[model samples]
Target: MLARQLEQFSCIRQARVQLAPQSWQSGAVIVLEPARPEAMPDAAALDRMLDTLALIPDAPDKRHVLVFDTEGRRLYPDHETDETARREQEVALERQALRVLRPLLDGNGRAEVLVSLDEAEKGRTTGRRTISVLLEENAVPETVRPHLESLLGQACALEEGRGDALRICFLPARRNAAALRGLALTFAVLALAGMAAFF
Candidate 1:
């Protein structure tokens, strides 16, 4: 099944799929190798692989069907292990989520909202991996908060984390979540890439 998907990418020279389940992980897995000795799946190649995996029945779980490079380095599931990589991937997810979810959140832009991403396995009969979207409190005006939350609940395919929605959290913070965590006692805006990219 995966081999056919790999063949579509001209950049891949070799591909391998393994079911090496760890105590922390359960079910199937995908371990990829580079096309050339020095090459790895770029963004386009990655989307090709993940998109195929998405078509499989009962396959919204990204944790099991993950992407890794030739060196056995995680590409898709890179968040928990690498801090810098985590920020990049997590922020990327957050930024994109905000871009899609922002317009839906009315009376926002009073202050910047910092989003954090995490993953978990949920379900009673058949468990599945779910993306956890955590939003700092005050993301929207107090009046709009409930609506924003309800709208996002409808966005995800399943209700794993919300009372029914995928795992969405409203982080309670004393100050701006980004600045508070980025540099304590420092009032600075650590704009990633550009604020425009998110807005």
Candidate 2:
């Protein structure tokens, strides 16, 4: 069944279908990764793929499905009122934002960011052309900070958007795994001391 479904899209060189035992929302999960990084599925091909996913069994739950790209972008079940799509879009945006921001981090830096689209009105057309990156406390270097914003702008310009949108962000930079080990050791020592005092 999967092989037949895959043959329809030449752009989709490979496909995988997994019937997960538990889902936050119950349905089949279809993952598609392109043969090339730059390959994108057109609207009609995407629609057909969604239709193919619809045929999968939803015996124990409602017939809802999710399709994700290699970069973690959600591609299916994008209904008008689906609240889940908003969360998925945020995830996709974050992945894209990180692609631009990670290079600025000079190895020691780590960050968690929230990427959002704020609508701006210029004239008759409505736009969410501005990409806003909210850097939740991070270890970004002071020297790299100056040039990071311009690089983001250039990165967005090279990609596609709803309109002539551009990217701009202030990404800041971690918790080392070694720090967690130290925390565990401290807890153990405290527990032993308390037990000794109690006895």
Candidate 3:
């Protein structure tokens, strides 16, 4: 089943998906590139869609990403009244989405949100806007480390060159075995010396 699901996802273009299970409910972010500026989805509509998705039995228990072909069509309704209103609504939806996914993110998983305006938008031609949260392995919520690692790999391919990759570096565990061995040897030598002195 997992293999089939992966095969189904193999054909998606310029799409990124992330999963975090340790966060409040489990979180995810999905971004699609080369999006047309005119087709964004409405914030309220997105919120409702996510809420409905959350209720699904197998709906990414934590978090996941769903990308659209364009920033405008992906996020806002076509009939939106004003640019300012549309922008505000987009921001609100992104914030709520992040909040919903926060609990799902673990120390191993990373959560990121990205937006790319139309190619003709001045100053945004070569740049993309992104927000992310990364947690190191075994830091707090250790159980989600493996899933986060896999998700990070997928995210890297999805958002390649868009920005610096988010990572959670693991700290090496401390080892006292050598010190204990030295201490034991010193105690043994001292005992031998004391026995010799008594002879």
Candidate 4:
């Protein structure tokens, strides 16, 4: 819907709109494939358009720095270095979210347990945190989700938001043990390193 609206504008030859969900409500990305019309909106005009869209939702935003293009040209909240900084911020947010989940995990299973984060929550962790757990075993233990959920249930009360603390979905492993171990190690290195010495 928004993509079509953007194309109708004289400046945009083609507007590809991908609405960014989870982090900021109104967050979106617009890619302009320079129109042949020879009168497309300039970098400055496009920046303003992005800002207007960012505020379109009724909710207050978390001061998003939206990218107008991949050239590291335009950004929101006016001043910033480049897109690399934004990438680093994303890494930081992921780290924080993982930290929030670390305590509930047993971190001792031989199974290649894959802790997953929703792509939307990858940008920001807010409200009730949701995570997926995939056990790289022929049969995932019945205790996995229940144990984790039980831990989370004790971590906070419903009034304190434990009811939505974390949602763990599971899938049985299909790979050979060795491959699963290697994948689990790689994921652990990226997601759980420094999460705890116990891990």
Query: How many collisions per candidate?
Result: 2, 3, 27, 1
Which 10 residues in a row give candidate 2 its minimum summed lDDT? 18-27
**Each candidate: what lDDT?**
0.51, 0.56, 0.42, 0.45
Query: What TM-score does prediction 1 earn?
Result: 0.33
Can you give the TM-score per candidate against the true fold? Answer: 0.33, 0.42, 0.25, 0.33
Q: What ranges in model 1 sit over 4 Å off?
A: 20-26, 43-48, 57-60, 81-199
What are the runs in model 4 whose C-alpha is more than 4 Å off? 36-40, 47-67, 70-78, 81-199
Give me the candidate number with maximum lDDT. Answer: 2
- Name model 2 segments beyond 4 Å from true: 1-31, 34-99, 108-128, 134-136, 157-174
Estimate the lDDT of model 3: 0.42
lDDT of 2 by residue, 84-132 (tens): 4443554455567678777766566555444344343566233343455
Error in Å for residue 124 of model 3: 36
Q: How do all the candidates rank in terms of lDDT, highest first?
A: 2, 1, 4, 3
Worst 10 residues of 1 by lDDT: 109-118
Q: What is the per-residue lDDT of model 1 for residues 50-118, given as tens digits with 9 covering 90 to 100? A: 777666664444444556665546676544553234334533443454665677543443223233333
